[model samples]
Target: MDWDKLRIFHAVADAGSLTHAGDTLHLSQSAVSRQIRALEESLNTTLFHRHARGLILTEQGELLFDATSAMSRRLDTAEARIRDSEEEVFGELRVTTTTGFGSLWLAPRLPALYKKYPDLKIDLMLEERVLDLPMREADVAIRMKEPSQADLIRRKLMSVHMRLYATPGYIAENGMPESLEQLSQHRLICQNVQATQVSAGAELVRELLTYDVRSTLTVNNYFGVLQATRSGLGIGVLPDYVVEDFPDIQRVLPEVESKEVPVFLAYPEELRQSRRISAFRDFVTEEIIAHRKKMRQESESGA
Candidate 1:
């Protein structure tokens, strides 16, 4: 019934030790124990099973702990939103994206963002797993496809295609493949078809495999594939965006490409007004524009 008692119980359940919880809460063990006892008496239930090593939550304690955890997350969301209302775009902004894009593309452009907002703290989570933005798993996400989750504000950033590439030395040494049939002569570097990659990329790799490539090197992520290609290991199936940063890697079999994989930036509807989110979204949009311009200029010069 008492908010203070609920808070104490939450901490104790989280730590599984009365003394440890007391240290975290800045209260003595006896004081914390008194609060837990008073709370249990008020609820008419035993919240934890006593043991010599540590305390274990009873069934009732588990239910209460679950409720408290939800409350804690909500409070965190509220705190972040409140901080966002301030004038400065400063504080931790958790961003999630695929390892390939995060490392190869986004990470390279982060300096400009830091220059503009030096006070901002970024926590970059690079993985294939899609975080739950609405549930606050991450504050923002840049995904290979449009998010299917409900209550998200999604924006399409750009589209990418998987294309073959190789180092000039590798091409000179092994010769280039001019057609699908000729591709079989060289080793293929790519993400394994079974790995967690965009459907379009996986499909391209599958089609490439059918060419009966003489040898293959499959990595779980595009970063690994890029590294191998850079090292002159073999022709690699990689996203066209990679060419922006790695101009030295020549595109092989230009006509051989995959279906378009749309990239999207998404955030929770509740964070629509967050200044931190706005700053990050605008920064990425600007970078995309600049990237497109640079590529176009190179194309015109070559033409």
Candidate 2:
């Protein structure tokens, strides 16, 4: 019933130490300990199991901690919403995306974004794992495929394909392959078939392996594959998005490529009106448009 006791209990449970919680709350250890005791007495249940090392949450404490954690996330979301301004976009925006795309594409363009919104704090989480948007694990995601999660405001950004690429140096060292049959002479650099990635990319790599290829190198993500390929390690199968920024890497086997993969941007439906979300969404859209225009120009000029 006492909000102050609940607050202290949450802090202690989070820190797993009364002294640490006291330090955070700017209260003495004795004061924090007394508050915990009072809360336990009021609830008539043990919230923590005291130990010499620190404190462990009891079953009751685990339940309460879960509730408090959810509350904390909700409060954070509320704070973000309150900070959203019509005239300015400034707040923490947790953005999640595949490591390859995040490092190769998004991260490079972030300087411009920071220049526009000097106060924005972007926590860029680069991993393949899909974070829970509704639960506030992350605020937005730009994924290789459409997100299937519920309660998300999804937008299709673009499509990409797994195509063979090799630096001119690599091609000079290992003679260019004229066809699928000729690929046997060169090493293949790509994501492992079992790695978490787009199925089309894995399928293309599998098909390439069917050839009489002798040397091969497999990385867990496209970023590593790109690096290896750029280093003249071998020919790499990478997403088409790289061609614009990495002009020195030439596309190989014009006739050979994987099925197209759709890219999507998604955020919680609750963030549909958020100014930060709008700013990010518009920024990405504008960038994609510019990329598309450049790609078209390159294609036209090459043709």
Candidate 3:
């Protein structure tokens, strides 16, 4: 039950070699061995099966090692939390979102955040996979739909629609499709109906596919679709938000669009007071405001 013995046992079990554990702990091999022995004797169990190469944990040892490992990790996290500056917004913040949004929208706006919090470290995890914010898989998430996970503080950010777009060159060459029926004449670029994407987007792609488009380029993510569309590949089914960044691409088939897909920002309820989370939340809020303003101005100018 001694803490020191448990610590030595964890190091030894992790390394599986007494000399290696000793070297890591800055203790002699005999001393490390004594600690392990005393711990095993106290628990009345054979903690290890020793061989010439090293040691393997017995079932009992495995159980004890699991406990010690958890303890060690918790302690390390505690130490890190303690080391954080309570008054400053600084530390690693793991942010997760779909690749399309991260790369097209959020990633481009990060320089302002970096300017404000030069010390802050941001790990941007861009994927379709929804990371668990409550379990700390990621510190924050900006998702296409509201996260239904428990114990999360969620905020509605905006709504986006899946609309058809094509580069000027492509439209000029192929002639723009004026109606849904006419869309079938041009190659459609979009996310595969079965690919991991927002349901609304997939549904839009499915509906478009039903029009019997003769040729298609289906990418897994909107980023890929956008790149193909930019290259004058075909008419791309993409989120309306992308138009804010890519102004040259004109919308096609004005009546053909998906229902609005709501976007949400979520974080763990337990992180309500985390300074890093607050800073990031505020920064994103500001960016969203600016983005909306820019879009409004563009809309007005075009009108």
Candidate 4:
């Protein structure tokens, strides 16, 4: 089959109109229609049925569409790899990371990275949603939780030790919770990732003390919860590394400590050999390791 014809067919099927497909592909309307006709002839089956509303895919077209979609993605991945290898480290690197880490840590360090590799373009997407690496959704991912996907390469960046933190005003007004029993009297803020039965941080807090987890204000993002806590909203649990520099926030109860959450840097196994990925992975790993001592020192000082 002609790849160009198939590409046109895919565009037409997606747009549901020859004119729209032509505009998208920068081809004339007549050219698009001719390619579709050729594709149908080669396939020996009708692909689309036209109506006043739009073109509807026939049963044969739907089958072919699924296969072609996968093929197009694979081809795109191959092309990206080839282009990355051929050129200098000058292409775009798409990365997805959690909002808290991206905002607090990664965003600040990107300028230095850009300075080091002036030719490289970085697209940093701050989202909680896990992107699919195999589908080429993102070139790299930095997440708080470990990924279980077998096809990708996963590297543990660091373990984030969480501690209970509250603003000075909150502690002064509510008084510091000296022990587990006293913790129940203060308001607690929760950070929830999904609709899971229990959050790891919350579970750890519960396991450590007899505090009332029942009375809590839950937020979706970690940075929001941390900010809320910093503003004297309530006591919140956050990664030690994130709040280390905030002078207003103080660790409330040293007796109650949450378990450390592992952070992972993930990428497709095939892209491991690529210089861009390797360079990024190594830079991030070194940066995190360098900050490990500072993170520990902050936790200790706060305690």
Candidate 5:
């Protein structure tokens, strides 16, 4: 069987349609269909069943897909190894991170990295969603949550401490809660994502806010919650690093403590040995470690 034809068939099977696969592979839909047809003919078995939605994989196709997926990954890893052996840091480094951190921190520091390695090109994808690194969605990922995947390489970069904060105006108008028990009297801004997750920060909020806590406003993004808190809408529990720079917001109930959320850096196991990846990994690790103390100080000083 032609390797190219097998590759095309695999792409189509994974994408669920000829047009989608063609778009991904930068080939014409007809060419992709022809390749799949040729592969099926050579193998003397029907690979896909035609359906209204798209092509559904047959039994043979499913088995082929499983093997082909592994084979493709190995081939890609080998290619990466070969390129790295040439000592060139001149390839695309796809990075995935959350919006708040990417905007406030990582994006600003990228220029220094580029200055050091002019040949390296970076594709920064910032979103709240964690992109799958093992599936080649991103080369490296910086996430707020620890990765539970056993296949990938994961490292804890730092612990992010969160605190309850409110605008001075809101606190003055609503009467500041003297203790954790009085928290329910004031309006509260809740983050939907954080509320749904049982993190240390979430647990602390639940424990402290015993009074009829009003969750009038809900937002998915931390930045939105920060803005709401800054606008004097309500008090919100936010990362200290995120809210420290907002002059209008004041930390409330500093005694009401919560757990620290550990930030993690993750990447695929295959790319661990690549020179460029290793270089970047080392550089980022050093930078974060060196700045960890400063981050903590900034949080404490509300800088």
Candidate 6:
């Protein structure tokens, strides 16, 4: 099998048009067609179906395309690893995490990371859906639960709990709940039980709903709940980590909280030696350590 011909076939399959693939490869349409023909002959299979509009992949073509796509992603990972400079953490680091944690915690601390590594390029992908790390869908991930993917080097970051919070102004006007039974008197703000979230949070919301709450405000994400709570809307179910950054948000019925949700940071084992990964891992570990220390100091002083 000729490497060049396979490359051309991959391009043609990707573009679905011989002319478009030729343009991308900077080759003439006839030359591109010749290579595709050669590849098809070598494989002894009809790779595509010719149509008036564009090329559609045959079953064999789909299999080949899948293989080529994996190759492309592997090449990209290799390129990134090769580009990582020794003794310098400069290059793109694609980090994925839930929107709530990314926006609330990690994003706020990224300035520190940028200051230390000025040339570092960070592509933060925030969504609830877990990306495939081994497939190179993302470079690293910070997730609410431990990642069960094989070949991943994972580190437990910290644990978070869903707790009730309310702005001081709201508490001042509505008073505070002395116990879980008293929560029925005030409106509840939380993530909808049906939305995708940590199981503990949804369980907590389900348990809270049983209190016969008078009013309810349900948002899909914690950010929306936090915003509503900050606006004096109602008592919100939020993670305890927010307390450090939002001192004005007072804990309500501190005893009423969800089970602990463990947070983990994971990356492919292949990236273990990459300087960028080491830098990011160290930075996040240092930040979590500092956060724990500060929270302890505040607690001691308050005690």
Mark the regions of model 5 whose C-alpha exceeds 4 Å error after superposition.
1-88, 172-175, 193-198, 243-248, 296-303
* Window of ten residues with lowest summed lDDT in model 2: 78-87
Comparing candidate 1 with candidate 5, which one achieves the higher TM-score?
A: 1
Between candidates 2 and 5, name the one with more favorable lDDT. Answer: 2
Candidate 1 residue-wise lDDT, 1-303, digit = tens = 899999999999999999999999999999999999999999999999999999999999999999999998999988986766576788899999999999999999999999998889999999999999989999999999999999999999998999999999999999988899888899999998999999999999899889889999999999999999999999999999999899889999988899999999999999998888999999999999998998889889988
Count of clashes in candidate 4: 0
Clashes of each: 0, 0, 0, 0, 0, 0
lDDT of 5 by residue, 1-303 (tens): 798998898899999999999999999999998898889999999999999999999999999999999999999998986766677566689989887667756776777788877888899898877688888999998888888766789888877766789989998898788876677677777565454442765676566556667555776656777888889988887777654346578888887656877888889999877666776777778778767766677667764
Report the C-alpha lDDT of model 4 over 29-72, residue by residue, as the tens digit: 99998899888999899999989988999999999888889988
Ranking by lDDT: 1, 6, 2, 3, 4, 5
TM-score of candidate 5 on Cα atoms, chains taken together:
0.60
Off by over 4 Å in 6: 1-84
TM-score of 1: 0.73
Give one digit per residue, the lDDT tens place, for model 3 in 92-129: 89999999999999999899898998889999999999
Candidate 2: the clashing residue pairs are none
Name every residue pair that clashes in candidate 6.
Answer: none
Better of 2 and 5 by TM-score: 2
Colliding pairs, model 4: none
At residue 208, candidate 3 shows an lDDT of 86
Listed in order, each prediction's TM-score against the native is 0.73, 0.73, 0.72, 0.64, 0.60, 0.73
lDDT, model 6: 0.93
Candidate 1 — what's its lDDT?
0.94
Each prediction's Cα RMSD? 11.3, 11.8, 10.0, 12.0, 14.1, 11.7
lDDT accuracy of residue 89 in candidate 1:
82
